[model samples]
Target chain A: MKIAVDAMGGDFAPRAIVEGVLLAASELPSDAQIVLIGREDSIREIFKEHNFESSVVEVVHAEEVIEMGEHPTKALSQKPNSSIGVGFKLLKEKAIDIFCSAGNTGAMHVGALFSIKAIEGILRPAIAGYVPQLDGSIAIMLDIGANADCKPEVLAQFGEIGSLYAQYTFQIERPRVALMNIGEEEQKGSLVAQATYPHLKANKRIHFIGNIEGKDLFTNKADVIVTDGFTGNILFKLGESLYEITKQRGIQDDFIDKTNYESIGGSPIIGVNGNVMIAHGISSPTAIKNMIGWAYKQVQANAYLHIAQALA
Target chain B: MKIAVDAMGGDFAPRAIVEGVLLAASELPSDAQIVLIGREDSIREIFKEHNFESSVVEVVHAEEVIEMGEHPTKALSQKPNSSIGVGFKLLKEKAIDIFCSAGNTGAMHVGALFSIKAIEGILRPAIAGYVPQLDGSIAIMLDIGANADCKPEVLAQFGEIGSLYAQYTFQIERPRVALMNIGEEEQKGSLVAQATYPHLKANKRIHFIGNIEGKDLFTNKADVIVTDGFTGNILFKLGESLYEITKQRGIQDDFIDKTNYESIGGSPIIGVNGNVMIAHGISSPTAIKNMIGWAYKQVQANAYLHIAQALA
Candidate 1:
């Protein structure tokens, strides 16, 4: 199986990406290979500087580069040879088992939708964030920043799809799904949240655990936390910021350490046709390496296929 | 100044409330007095149990109690002699300097509206939460859990009223007001949030700062953080939970310690005609004591009068 890395992505692209790929190469199984997609010369230069040589890592040249600030749909069409563009092409063709990037989040999201596309019967594909739990486990929170304004039906669908992803990927049978809201009551929340609660409760595919308040975020209350992209994105980022806030104060704890973005590295765009993970824009070498590890696990889980099958 | 509290409110009512009042009575200024509103016998019994005696503490009898789960409007009308009802009556008649409760949040909000009513020109009154800042100061976040779904106008007004409250109550001149959003960009949020941006920016009364994400919650980015009640309530509760999660893990930090709900105690309802504050239903004696302290500060600040003057 081939795992593609966008070498010309993120703030410290090429160097950080290449160095991270090299780090991941050492842990990869014999059946797996890392495909570095970018300008071949730049990737080789980084490898040479690190005094690194690996038979498991291969470079695929892409002439054009999509800058971090470029518009998603426009850049994908205009710069077809861009690293992100080519990476999606390879993913669509199944040349790579999974595609991971720390590039422009919008471009990556747009590229995935335009390439492999959303799975059949999917209303809207969502970005799923990994929330570290107090019990050393992780919960999957969907629509992190994908659809900022989702309807009630859309949010309810997230609960269903997110449950499937968590069950198959994380191996949690009948994963407990909860709606992220202001209160624990079904009737308490914004109009959209209030309306979505019943839909989630009515769904028989997953274990609906009712509403989970903000205080229950890291308490291992549920396996899948579903919300619209707007609230989910803010909460996810806030959760990630805890690691930096605590670290700056010279405070250390086992659970707090996992809050670091580098621990999980990437958030998968679930409900899509194939495996696609998007990392932080400021992702470091360690973060990239960790992302690749998760990428390998996602490839193994084949959650997208399960979602498609369930929907079908 | 006379500060009134609902002794029959909260999970540990009468006992915790009376004990807390005694705690505050010792520290209150000579001119200030504590008016305990509930069954006079129950309060005196707790005061007797604690071996506490103070000239500053007085008791007022209210025959009925508003349970935590009771409907706000229904309970207030049916139980006219309830603690919350008597407290609001005292506040309306100017018999008390300020009224605070840890009971039925909805009743307190509804009572304030029905009694003192909202300040003239105010579309809606909001519950303002005190967010602990990294710099050891506090930022005022409005609409914590008052109106779940706020229109753009209501949210924009929160920014203005919140700014005024922060400036006068916190004694900050020209407080920086910011919109709480998913992203830092103006156009990047839900439909209501996007529409509210331009309104906040155009308001001449506030020192409007751009968007502040959830990560910026305690970063001292702004003095007044504005958002709809749904998002604001969840974020506030989430921020408060950090203290407990960290404490359970035996992690200690000066900054994280401030995240404790007991640190400040109560969240004040802004845009109301009178000074009204509410605490957690599970408030302990320490929390009640601290809330009384803030109640004293609120009376001194006279923030409600200032907001009324500004709108006029």
Candidate 2:
């Protein structure tokens, strides 16, 4: 299996990506191949500085780096030879089994959708994240800003996708799926949520846990939580901010680990045709290393195949 | 001035309410009076336990109590002699300067709307809470689940209400008011937010700080944040859950201190005809005491008068 890494992306760019690739190369099985995409000279210099051999690590030179502020689709279109673009092209051509980037998330999502394409029946692909709950369990929140406007059927699809991801990723059997709403009552939410509740309740494929409030998010009410991209994105960001604020307030807990960027490493752009992992723009070297490892694990676990089969 | 207290409300009920009223009475000027509305037996038992004087606190016998599980409007109609109902009656008859409760929030909101009614020009009254940000500043977030289905005009009203509250409570001169949206761009948001943006921007009475994302909420990007009740309620509850999760995780900071129920006490229901303070149902003795003080401040400040002037 081969994996392509966008070495020029993220805050800790070339250095972190370089170190991560080397670390993965050392620990990965001999059958696994690694390719780093970035500027030729910088990649070479870093490779030499790390005293890494050229045999296990390969570099694909690219001239441009997509800025976080750039228009995602426009930048990807304009910069065809950019690290992100080239990396996705490699995955498209089957040159690599998977591609990973720690760069502009919007650009990553756009590039993944256009390059890899969505699954046959999927209306819209989603991004999922784990929010640590008080009971030492993780809540899997999906569509964390992938598609802003969603239909009731689309939300039901999210419930299926999110529940499967939680079952596979967190190893939870029969993951409980809850629709994020303002209140637990059937008549409590926006028009979309109200319409979606009945469908989720009737869906026999997944364990529908009914409506869960935002306050109950951290209380471990459900293993899998589903919502539209708009609300999901806001909730995801709000949860992230709250975690940071709490840590800043000197609240120390094991759940508030510094390994957030490192352990989770990156978010897999699920429902896409191929394996694609997008890391945070501000990820560190350790995080980058973990992302590469995560990509490899996903490939080994046949995540895409499972998702495709589940949807099928 | 006379304030009616729902002595048989909340987890601690008459005991905590009696203690809180006594503490508040001792701190206030000699002319201030309190009416503790509950069953005479329970009120007298609490008063006897505390060895409280009858001159400062008056007990109004109420035959019924509104249970947490009961429907607000239905319960009010069914049990007119309930403590909450009697308290509302006092406020309606202009016999009490203010009515405070730490009971069922929905019931309180329902009773307040039915009893006190919205102030003259107000289309819909909103619930506002102070969220402590990372910068040690509080952002007044409003319409946190009062009118879930709201219009742009309702959001603009929320902004106005929140702006006025921040100016008076936090004493910020010309507080910056921001509309919460997916992005800072003018074009990014639901139909309601997009329509409300231009009106808020044009309103000379408001500071109009533009659109802010969920990530910017805890950073104190704006002093007054407004949104439809649906989004506002989700955000408010998310903030609360974060505070709880972080506190449980042991993240200690001054911001966490501010988030404590004891410090923030109860939230003032804005746009109402009379002062109505709503404490958390799980409030402690300290929270009840602080709520009493907050109620006193609101009454003295003539919060309703200022709100009327601002909206006039």
Top lDDT: which candidate number? 1
Point to the candidate with the largest DockQ: 1
Evaluate fnat for each of the predicted models and list the values in order. Answer: 0.75, 0.54
What would the per-residue lDDT of candidate 1 be over residues B1-312, giving only the tens digit for each residue? 999999999999978878888888888888899999999888888988888787788899999999999999999999999999999999999999899999999999999999999999999999999999999989999899998899999999999999888888889999999998988888889999999999999999899998999899989999999988888888888899999999998888889988999888899999899899999988888899999999999999989898999999
Model 2: residues with Cα > 4 Å off, grouped in runs: A19-31, A135-137, A246-251, A258-263, B22-31, B242-253
Q: RMSD to native for every prediction?
A: 0.8, 2.7
Tell me the spans in candidate 1 whose CA falls farther than 4 Å from its real position. Answer: none
Give the 10-residue window scoring lowest on summed lDDT in candidate 1 chain B.
B14-23
Worst 10 residues of 2 chain A by lDDT: A252-261
Tally clashing residue pairs in candidate 2.
8
lDDT of 2: 0.81
Q: Number of clashing residue pairs in every model?
A: 0, 8
What are the candidates' individual DockQ scores?
0.83, 0.61
For TM-score, the strongest prediction is: 1
> Residue by residue across B224-311, what tens digits does model 2's lDDT show?
8887677777877777765566666555566766767667678888898888888878777778777877777677776677888876
Q: Assign candidate 2 its CAPRI class.
A: medium
Candidate 2 at B132: error in angstroms?
2.4
